[model samples]
Target: MELSSLKFYNVIVLGFAFMLMFTGFQTCGMVEQTVLKSYRNDSIVNGTVTYNGDGYTSLAIIYVVFAFANWLAPSVVSVLGNKFSMVAGGITYTLYLSSFIKPITATLYIGSVLIGFGAADKQRIPLYIGLTSVCALGTALLLILRSHPIQKLEVGDPEEDQPSEEEEETSDEAAMLNDSLDVTHRLSWKLFLTRDMMILSITFFYTGLELTFFSGVYSTCVGATERFGEDSDKLVGLTGIMIGVGEILGGALFGIFGKKTIRYGRDPIVLMGGAIHMVTFLLIFLNIPDLAPLNKTPDSAYITPNTYLAVACGFLLGFADACFNTQCYSIIGTSYPDNSAPAFALFKFEQSLAAAIGFAYSSHLVLKWQLLILVIFAVAGVVAFFVVERKVRSRAEPSGSSYRNI
Candidate 1:
């Protein structure tokens, strides 16, 4: 007997993703830094650039697009064919990968529109909030649904025969009632009510905020500090080095300790990852200099051990990001089999919405409070940790059907 079609598809989807995601993910680290550095001189507040309704017209636009993406992801999947959706998303990402956004008025606006429009083609995001968000959203949408050509079919035994429409209706209705899902209501909306997914979703909001700060404030630290120099782009590029190193370490750790992590499943891993995330963030926040000149000075002495520590912490942060994501996905897949696609979709939504809000919030906070914003953001990370354990972990379970079941 041959391998099942479902198994084949799974291999193709995940295998291709595992292979290509690196190129996409590694590219993103640098792109994010560049975008953040673009606003170096234009930072309205501290090192942040909160997009108010007017001041951040471009960020504002992108925020709306992301929100729209959240709303559309679940609802719009069937409307676009998988191939078309993939093509659209590819085109859109290519634009971002090539052009991205800048501090300037013109390019940023164009980039936002392109990114938003391209991102809207498909739905559902992935385990993490970064590259996963980019590819997962579209991949989930396509993966969730299936339709085989008539020729692929073979006759089945009587016991395995298809159920009658009445039986299906009754089953669907009963399932809906049992899950408290209203059959008449929008399917996607109800899908959002998964408690465990919500926990991750809430944390994503914090993730977005953290990333916004990371991109902008990280550059800020390097920029105003005497060490990195005026070329913020080059300083920001250091993120790639740290992320690359961390990814290599993460792979090695996964290779050595894979079974141990899986034996406990993702909860402990998520918890540990969350702790690492919170601590690294705290370390980064604590290190930010309170008083610094806006312009460069001859003494430029910020590149002390603190900068090296920050770099090391950055590597840990990236590792934490990867670990939490991988574990979370494994958990969702095992726990909520039926709702896995929806789970991931909601995950992306939270990340996107959070980033949109976080960018604006951090911008404002950094301007008014400086290090205080990063400090509180670190607190938010802690809160995010508890929220997952208390609110999400308890509820994650063997509910929802796999796409095949549906």
Candidate 2:
């Protein structure tokens, strides 16, 4: 359908924005975890490195900084506005990416910290810079567009005459009181203890953990296995590409068909994703070799990754990831519209904490055990999803309100 036929701002512009932002940030992320981290860690593992101690330390720093940065993001966004906040974040990302070009221990650590700081906001800085840089030319195209959306305050418009000193003072006091209430009421232990929060927290933690597996562990596995012989680095990068493709497709599919499946509730979608992930983990456990140094002999054949299977697993993991993540966001937004800011902030905080923990221990875990752990978590996440959905339905039924799809 034409852009005019659809809701341009909500459907088209927002979709394009998400795609652009995703491509910029996710591409950098995929490369960082899969290709760059592999190269860094492989060197350390082989005893050929002096700087960048095992890469996990750097990741830990990034996530740790990110966890605390979430608290500051809202204030930053309020001050900078969405466009400038994105631009600011992009600058940090560019700095982080540039450090990789001449990665020393100092630069790597600094870059990681910068990325973490930028990531506290909705869009990390470096990715936004890349996305916006590319889309600069598209601004000319926007000049020809005619749509303009305006937001008006719900309260009646202000009078032309200035307010008296007493009225102004009262208004200022009221505004301060409202702001205090907004901050205090936005977050609460009661809300945090809700079923939806529990499910979202568990699933988001998995999201961070799975990301670590892909970026740190999985890439290392491919490299150590000598999956592409002399070209394993290239292959690892390619695997990341497959996963990115899968994520894009999965996101698009959900965007298109999510409403149709809403009648069945979010748990089914989450379960489907978890099932896909479990299968992928099983295949990985069975097929992919460990990250340990291999001893190949003339009599012994090299156990390389099956090209088809590797690609398939990557795609499926990414797709399943999208299912869990998007649905979590949808649930939080719809369930607690008033409390969404802190709810999502807490979500990001937990995600960063999990990622930090996962990355800190990633280098120590065996491939099989890692996969097994993921499978278990996936199962648990599905069960949690079901519980949340049922609780929501029960609550809604008592209120004579029907649960709606994301």
Candidate 3:
């Protein structure tokens, strides 16, 4: 649909909200991961034997909490609704970020715990409180507009009067009641054990695993090399920026062309992303141009062609990530419209669990082996997805519809 279409106003608002909120969260997360490594090397935190590793360990432990919290998210969303759930998530995020304001080890751990709760709800607090405040304001504005007299927009129709405050309150109460009922039903194994869920879960596992590698280990790999020397940390941070750039481009591309891709089913887009991701992994596995440290001056260290190649790989990784993630979300939403709450909760659960595992082992794995493992998972996820799509199409063809009844 056209961006200006009034029918898509809610979509527009939600899209902006996602962008504004995620930008802050992702940037802060990148900094946190990068600094975790940097701090370990420099002993930046007081009263900590190893600040760097402890930082990551803290996050990993929290992710374990997050996996369990996924089951609680629907209830939270049901009660607070998306807007208020986000607001509550934002508050938790604010608390976590504030912990960093003082740079104490204890505070950092506390912040990690608080953020874990936010992450369970898939909310990332903005680094700047002002940004979170703006989101809250925007949400409030939307709520007001939803209830405002001008919402009717029927210029000369006397038949329809603006809803009264009591009427509005009643409407909201009814919605909340319905949502609560929906949440109470709970997900069944029968509904959760389908081929589609299996395929999606595997891919989501890879998503979690891949993200940890990038955010947790990729920078360390670059920085640990003898060539980047002390400048490794800085370059690692730069690579994070490149990944973000690719993610923006990838998300925009998918947003613009997703409708066309949907006609072919979600598999094509997902496979395309997986293929791109594999190529990037292969580059890392081969160690193209050799990223080993060369003991060069800090200013000259990052000027090499190999460094740029790593940055380029980061971009492709983000781009491919966007493609995979967007298609998965679209498919799940469309396939299980009625049961989407549980479907997404399971999705997040799988992703968070896989991420926790990845983080726990990242410090110990060899780079080539890690890439090898990811590549294998990537192929498996794609194969499973392809099989699921084929079955879905075959069933749909006999029924004379584009999608099967899940």
Candidate 4:
């Protein structure tokens, strides 16, 4: 196969690897609030204490640690190399899943911490129980699959200032043998403080905020609405499926049309995502009760609880999420192609921090208030993204000829 074909093939394989792992982890995460809240407070199982309503706090802890861990991740990955890094990350996830069997506060919290280090997401319990096997298979696949080959950049002379293939392999081996902590820290922080990065951080934070809302808060609210009747828990899972379907469709649409969209830049897509999210928020504000996030509510704010509408909102939420996330990946990949790892680390740090904050407030705030916050961030984020996009484009254009051409 051609090198370009191999490169594309590697990208596809990597994406599927992540999907296999996240499918199980996130499916379980979707219903964590409902399941954990059901545990009787002060109850003992196998002589371990059970605390009710700890799910929000647990999710919060994961993102909190994940935020901090992002800084160290580059160093760790550099030291371990791509293959071993995957192995180590997979192990952390496995350990986290193992903790679920015993169901103790210590195990749960500790598991959260471990998985946070590994960068994990979660779901509903019986589903998690079944999905654990799927996650394990994904982990094993990482071990079985070959590491992706790095494609050299085309800019400048291919031979000039570039190491030979053997030298590159040797350098990679040396990096794995040496500590990269100091270099990783310096590059990550330096890039993070740049004007472009600082502005883009707003969009990153907004992405995380909406992620928490759709993944955890919204699912919980859906389950808590008494108007959904006794099968509300089931509805949460159904909502998750709808969200997944939307995400898949959105991803497919963009992925296929990406070549055509490349000339337009990301601002339009970001604005469209922001608009979709605003609409979703509006639907939530009208259809879901104010107190839905906190507990079961008998009625919605204005409209009667329509299960179809609720699931439809989930679909919209997921579709918008795809737009933002794909743009984020594109932006980071293009803007800092030479320093992509650090750029990604910085993005993850900001995004996870916002997710942590959102989870922290999820249990306290009403659904309407949460929706309001999302709206504010959505507007701010879209505007910030547009500004940065223009700045980047201007920098790419020939400064003197820009006016002459126009």
Model 4 residue 194 CA deviation in Å: 2.4
Which candidate should be chosen as best, given lDDT against the real structure?
4
Taking the tens digit of each residue's C-alpha lDDT, what string does model 2 give over 1-406? 3445545644555445445444544455544444344445445645666544345667778888998887766557665655566556656655665554445678878877887811112223444355445433232223333344333234576744444755776568656755754674456455667757876677778877887776555655554454445655455567777788778887887756767667777888888888888888877766576553121112211344566677677788788888888777777776777887678777788888888888777667656667777777777777877777777677777887767643
| Candidate 4: pairs in clash | 28-122, 28-123, 28-124, 29-122, 29-123, 30-123, 31-123, 31-124
What is the C-alpha local distance difference test score of each model? 0.49, 0.64, 0.63, 0.78
Candidate 4 lDDT over 144-252, as tens digits, reads 5554455566667557444677697777875653445566667889998899999999999999999899888998888888887777877888999999998887777
- Decreasing TM-score order of the candidates: 4, 2, 3, 1
TM-score of each: 0.60, 0.76, 0.74, 0.83
Residues 289-346 of candidate 3: C-alpha lDDT, one tens digit per residue: 2222111122222244366777788888888888877876776776677887677777
Q: Which candidate number maximizes TM-score?
A: 4
Model 1 stretches with alpha carbons more than 4 Å out: 1-64, 73-80, 97-104, 117-188, 191-200, 214-220, 229-233, 247-259, 290-306, 367-406
Q: RMSD, each candidate, Å?
A: 9.7, 6.9, 6.7, 6.1
- Once fitted onto the true fold, the runs of candidate 3 whose alpha carbons sit more than 4 angstroms away are 1-20, 40-53, 78-81, 117-185, 229-231, 288-305, 402-406
RMSD of 4: 6.1
Tell me the deviation in Å of residue 110 in model 4: 0.4
Instruction: Tell me the tens digit of each residue's lDDT in model 1 across 154-192.
Output: 666445434475577655754554353233234546656
Better of 1 and 3 by TM-score: 3
